[model samples]
Target: MARPFRRYSAGARWYDVLSGERWVYRAGRVAGIGLMDLQAGDVVLDLGCGTGLNFPLLRRAVGEAGHIVGVDRSADMLAVARARARREGWSNVTFVEADAAELDVDGLRARIGAATGRATADAVLTTYALSVMRDGAAEAWRRAVALVRPGGILAVVDMQPPTGRWRILAPLARLACALGGADIHARPWRLVARDAAPGSVREAAVRGGHIVAAVGRSPGEVAPTARS
Candidate 1:
């Protein structure tokens, strides 16, 4: 069992600095959000939103008119996220502490609806999060995808072994992931590859392909109707 939620609890305060955001990782979030093509008033769900690392990007993409509902299982992580929001004076973000893999999408939708007056979000994003879910990752992905409105977006960014020449760093990559309580081989981006509209999927790689971001339009933007 992953005990790092507790381990992470102690490190939440310094996650931004110690998480290697500057030297690595940030590019994945950038590419993922860029592919989202988010508009000004969209509501976005940030799953496993550890310390709100994606907040600045999501915030910039959505702007002040939009809302962000971040869900994480760690109270400590959410505490940092909440503090970040307060520091930035961002009134548009909300943090909910719950396991994304086990989240109640209907209730979550209701909560989001109550806040945004919309039953579903315009986009759903997860970064280096699914792989950490272990056995719960698939259910988490399903619930997160279901939380988006039809025609909305699903973006996932995660890590795998470094590719080609970068393979020389494979051991280092595994070390980073293992230390971070992540499954380096997850390749969770496959979820988007398998489910998105054929032409709507966009993919990008960074850090020698150790990190990947995939964005795709959800199935059925509009419900089919009866013909006259």
Candidate 2:
């Protein structure tokens, strides 16, 4: 079934503000740099790309020669992304309106590589957005895995349930969501971590909480193990 796009459309304007506060803290730039190992001439897909907040960072990584395809279910969000692309004169970036769960992976692959004259992306980045997806994230991840060619990477960042005593911060997590127009307590990261292939999931502690960031190739390809 097609996912509801209205949920994100209504919140598009507020998405960036909420994400900026939660993820863009001290050392976030550094972490983003590390997570997005972009290369010149590489093609990238920014999934659940809200307001295209990650565009600048992605542009820097991919360089002028590469391209970024920002996909989101919200037309409002894509509008912001398109406007930003125009304002920045980034002709290489394109925004598409599509449900994350039902994205046209083959079509996108053709678009990204066709424009760049390449066969596959160097990386795919999804940040902070997947945790809130209603369902079908597993299929989404599987599609992501299939979209990239051998040796490419999938970088994901999302909140995790607090561990041990830090679980007390559950209220803060809810506040972060409330401020951002999201569920007060969504924990899709746990599901991803559980289903993720062993040695392919890494956890990064952001502020007082943790976010999972994983990188790997297609299921059969040998890729770096999850960093301990």
Candidate 3:
């Protein structure tokens, strides 16, 4: 976490500009959130939220009545995220500055309950954040899932080497992932498929499969129709 946070600190101010939000990474989150199919008044957790790039899309889905809990370890990145919420006059958004790997689940639950009157979120999302967690990725993912209620949504959007004709851009993709402290080979979205209710998984591949998004209901629910 510190390694990625180190790079994030130096680039936090310029992240939205240089992070390829316009032409690249944003599409992954869009696909992932779309698969989540969030409803208005839902309480969603944005794990490793960074500079709140996902805020606009999430706000649109959940609307003003819903709550967003943005979690990240980097103070610099959280600073930018806070600025975004403030600038947008988003009163429903709260932030927790903590490493997802070392998060105190009970403390987080209490906080979320206090903020939104619910201990568990309706859905939890992590976009382009897990692979960068390196050794702590799985632990972080576990803690994230614990913060959601049974049958809540789980979504992951992460990177991998491009496929098909986009293979020609693999080197550039690797370079981008390296600079961002991500492991392009991680394929973290697999966790969604693993934990999803049977036949409930929804998936999409964007940016020629370099960016893959997977979403599904967490355990404890009857399976729903699948989509891909």
**Model 2 TM-score?**
0.79
Q: If the candidates were sorted by their TM-score against the true structure, best first, what order would they fall in? A: 3, 1, 2
In the range 70-119, model 1's lDDT, one tens digit per residue, is 99998889998999999999999978888887899889989998888888
lDDT of 3 by residue, 49-86 (tens): 99999999999998988899999988899999999999
Per-residue alpha-carbon lDDT of candidate 2 for residues 20-136, written as tens digits (9 for 90 to 100): 544433233346446556677677778777787778878887789878888787789888888889999999986777777888888877776677766566666776666656466
Better of 1 and 2 by lDDT: 1
lDDT of 2: 0.64
lDDT of 2 at 221: 52
- Candidate with the larger TM-score of 1 and 3: 3
lDDT (C-alpha) at residue 33 in model 3: 92
Off by over 4 Å in 2: 1-7, 18-33, 163-168, 178-201, 219-228
For each of the candidates, give the backbone clash count.
0, 1, 0
